[model samples]
Target: MDAQQVFALLCIGFVLAAFDKKKEHFPLPLLLLAAGILCSFVPFFSNIEVTRDLIFDWFLPALLFVAAYQFPYRDLKKDAGLISTLATIGLLLTFILLGISLYILLSPFLEVSLVACLLIAAMLTPTDPVSVVTILKQTGPQEAADIVEGESLLNDGTSIVLFTLMSTMYFESQQFSINSFLIDFLLVTFSGAAIGLIIAFLANKWMHLIKDNEYHIFLSLLLAYISFYIAESLQVSGILATVAAGLFLSRHFHVNGDKEVKERLDGFWGIIELLMICLVFLLIGIAGGQQPYISYLYYILAGFLLMIAARYIVLALIMYLIPFWRHRFHFQDYLILGWGGMKGTISLALLLGLNAGGKNSEVIFTLTFGIVFLSIFIQSLTMYPITRKLKAQEQKKKESS
Candidate 1:
């Protein structure tokens, strides 16, 4: 489809979704996924192709920046311990457990290697911030939501590091060295963070000099692209840099001078987000349709089981280590946390970026997409119910006291 047609369809979808009060029943992503699938059935629409350059260069940076800019820095700081644990140690545990579980499950049927399994696990490790934060704003507790957002932000960087390392190992047939891995991971993360900090500091210092609202808004948008580009050029994590810049700008730049400008910027970005959401889900559905469903039926089922088992095991381990978590967050809270870690566009993008000639590339991509689809549809839809129940239980306890 041409850009105009794509934008038109996206606008229609956004309007329908925005006006519909029953958003809980048919979330935006699910709706977009359905629309994409339905559209693909048409002859003309079937030819629509989503390019990696569009996603990596245009959409991702914008999405990351918006998420980062809107995120409350002070609230994130307050729950630093919980967020840190979940994003870092929690992510590592999830990757290891999930990787092992998938390896064991797929070992008998397919000659799935450990490295390939790890790559898949790493790809799905980071939860999509856009979906989670949007949902959390409505259903989760204030403190819990902040922690969730913070964890999501940091986990994206961590997951990319793990995914990049595992992808290299799989394609290059390289042996794993702890020292080398740690050094690479640390360097990527630190460099991304540093770039973000520098951009934020400079933006803050100069933002006061700009009096025009339109110009200020433009600067914010430009800053997002600059951060991502600079980070990528430096061989650091562009995702991390975009996020850091967003957070920095949000905290430092005030929208007080012109309400109209602020509103216009918000509206413009809101449109961008909706279009991106539709494009992403559309790509996901198209990718899903390309796979032979019957061939991977058993593998998909096994993957589902493995993911759940891994999540529970990891949660149990984390809870055991930090007894305070058990007291602070109940069983339902843990369950929601595990389930809410739904994989989305980032995972799909990474899968597509994998070398097609690499061994097990097709199988890995198909299974990854299937696993991610199930995670988003089943887990994301049910997360709010679980969280609501947990919140009710907490409220009851407080009332009794």
Candidate 2:
């Protein structure tokens, strides 16, 4: 889109955000999306297309950094084991199962390869940190919120790595081996994280040189993009790098920096987060409205249901069957986390990046767009009620005791 179109969308997003803030009933992301769809009927909005570069290069770093910066380091340390397992092993399991399921169901009717199916799985694997984390912080248990958010912060890297690997194998005909893939994954993931930590440490120390807290915030904003850009240029996961920087900087600032500065930082990031969320959902809505995929409604529903099943199945295996996680959370906690794994702009961004070999491109796009919409629309609305019920049940149990 041109500068004028982009500015217009931001203006609209700001207005929608104001309306959502005042009304305080509907979810802001959903409202923004609906508004985008409505606005798309206008000729001016109909041709707006969100590119992959716009998301990965421009939008994602800020959104991911804000989330990581806000997350409590204490909570992360406490739930590190569960979060790691879910982000890595749980994601792998969901990807494998969902990919296999899609291949079985779709290959019969559509011109899709197994790798393409797996690519689709990779796109949908990363739980969106934006919507789920926001709602859970308000209504869900603190522990549940921590686990979900933490997993999201870590898994975006893994999911992107997976997508890149699968995309290479599909598009470039690159030979894949389990051993080499594992080695590459570890190297890329940890290297990005290490770089981010080092940058964050340096950034924190530099903060001491500046007396103004405002400069500190500006430096952090710079740090987010710098860490991300450097990592990406080095062929590693920029998402993880940005996230690591955010987390480390947050912890350092909270523990040693001025209290007023931390509050100011929080307030600054809060507005940034809101603006990004509004623009992303609004753009997705407007883009989706232009190409209504009603014909693929069945595939969309199937993919959405399969994604949910894959999530619960992984959670069940990890939370209920595994000895380590079994006692940590109640069944309701798992239910909330499982159901709250909503897909958002990231999945769509990945889909936009995919080539999908030509004929299967439409199928992949439809599935990605359709499922993400249903996930954001249905799961976002319902998660709060589910979380509220779980809290109520826990409260009742405590009262009886």
Per-residue lDDT of candidate 2, residues 1-401 (tens digit): 78888789889988877766522235787788788888789888766877788888988899999999989888899899889999999999999999999888888887888998898999999998877655557666777888899998999878887888888887777887899779878978999999899888899889989999889889989999999999999988888999999999778866886688889888999988988887888887876775557878888899889999999999898888777688767788888889878888778888888764555677778888888888988887776677777778888999999
Best by lDDT: 2
TM-score of each model, paired residue for residue: 0.91, 0.95
Runs of candidate 2 with Cα error greater than 4 angstroms are 21-25
- Write candidate 1's Cα lDDT for 25-81 as tens digits: 556776676666666666666667665566678778888788887776676666778
Those runs of model 1 whose alpha carbons end farther than 4 Å from true positions after fitting are: 253-265, 392-401
Give lDDT per model, in order.
0.76, 0.84
